[model samples]
Each structure stands twice: as structure tokens, then as C-alpha cells.
Target: MTFVTKIRLQSGNRPALDRIVDEIRSTAERKGAELRGPHSAPPERLSVPQYKSTAGDEHRQFRSWDYTVYTREMEIVGHNELARQVTEFDFPDGVHVEAELKQVEQMA
Candidate 1:
């Protein structure tokens, strides 16, 4: 039996996200674990309009706030301990990580 760990990392701070991904990749390589990739996904763009009141033309001069969220994914195969450590690893502020583990049975 082998465990497959799927990791998803996202952050508004691109530099921080890239740094975390690099660290995970290096750690997996040092452990000689089967690593898949740090695949990048299209960034999510969000916009919000800032206004003091819902309906007020007297002072309705406002700007739209924009933010971009970057995302990356990686897969660890047959490395339960390593995966656990990664999931428990402390990440920097503005970076978010989500990990999922699945058990697979080998077929002869």
C-alpha cells in the first residue's frame, strides 16, 4: 500500500508562495521521495468596489480594489512520513497550504 499526498498552496504574495514551493521540492529531493511537480495554476483575480454608502451620490468617488491569488500544486507518492511532516510544516504569513492523502493498493 502506498499513500499519495496532494498539496495545494496559494497566496496573494507570489514570492512567498514560490519560496514555500521551492522548500518543499528541496526537502522531498533530499529525502529521495517520489515527487511529482509544483504545477502552477492561473491566478485568481478579485475586485471589490469601495464605497462609503450603498446609495449616496453626494460623495461617491471610490476606487475598485483588486487582488490576485496565486496557486501551486504538488504530489508526493509513497512517502507518508514526509507528507505528514510537510503538512505540519510552518508556513510564512500570507501563504496557505492544503494537503490531502489517499491510500492506494498495488496490483500484481
Candidate 2:
């Protein structure tokens, strides 16, 4: 059986996100882990309505707070140690990470 670790990272801070990804890539390279891509996804633009007061007032609303979210995804193939390191990495503020582990069984 083999394990695959898929990591998804998202942040509004592009520089911070890229930095983390680069660090992971370097670590994987040093450890001789099979890494598949820091694949980039299209930036998602999002907006949130800002309210002046807690009270529900249609007129008392500020301009929409808009931001773009960037996402990067990578996979570590059969390198459980490297995957664990990545998942346990202490990312900076505003960066979100999601890791999924899947088991692959060979068919004889």
C-alpha cells in the first residue's frame, strides 16, 4: 500500500503563500521525496459587505471589502515523513492549509 498526501494552501498574501510553498519544495528536494507540483489555481475574487452598525440598516452600510484569494496545491507521493513535516509546518498568519491523506492499494 502507498500513501499520497495532498496539500492545499490558500492565503490573501501572495508573498507569504509563495514563500511557504518554496520552503516545502526545498525540504522535499533535500529529503529526496517524490513531490508533484505546487500547482497554482486561479485567484478567486471575493467581497464582503461592511456594516456600520450591528442593527440591520440598508442605508448604513460601508463599501464592500474586496480581496483576492490565492491557492496552491501539491502532492507528496509515498513520502509519509515529508508529508507529515509539511502538514505540521507552522505557517504564518493569514495562511490556511488543508491536507488530505489517501491510501493506494495495488491490485495483484
Q: Which candidate gets the maximum TM-score versus the true structure?
A: 2
Per-candidate TM-score against the hidden true structure? 0.88, 0.95
Model 2: runs farther than 4 Å from truth?
none
C-alpha RMSD for every candidate: 2.3, 1.0
On the 0 to 100 scale, the lDDT of residue 31 in model 2 is 98
TM-score of 1: 0.88
Lowest lDDT 10-residue stretch of candidate 1: 52-61
Model 1 residue-pair collision total: 0
Give the Å shift of residue 74 in candidate 1: 0.3
Q: Give candidate 1's error at residue 45 in angstroms.
A: 1.2
Pairs clashing within candidate 2: none
lDDT of 2 by residue, 12-104 (tens): 999999999999999999999999999999999999999899995879999999999999999999989899989989999999999999999
Give the Cα RMSD of candidate 2. 1.0
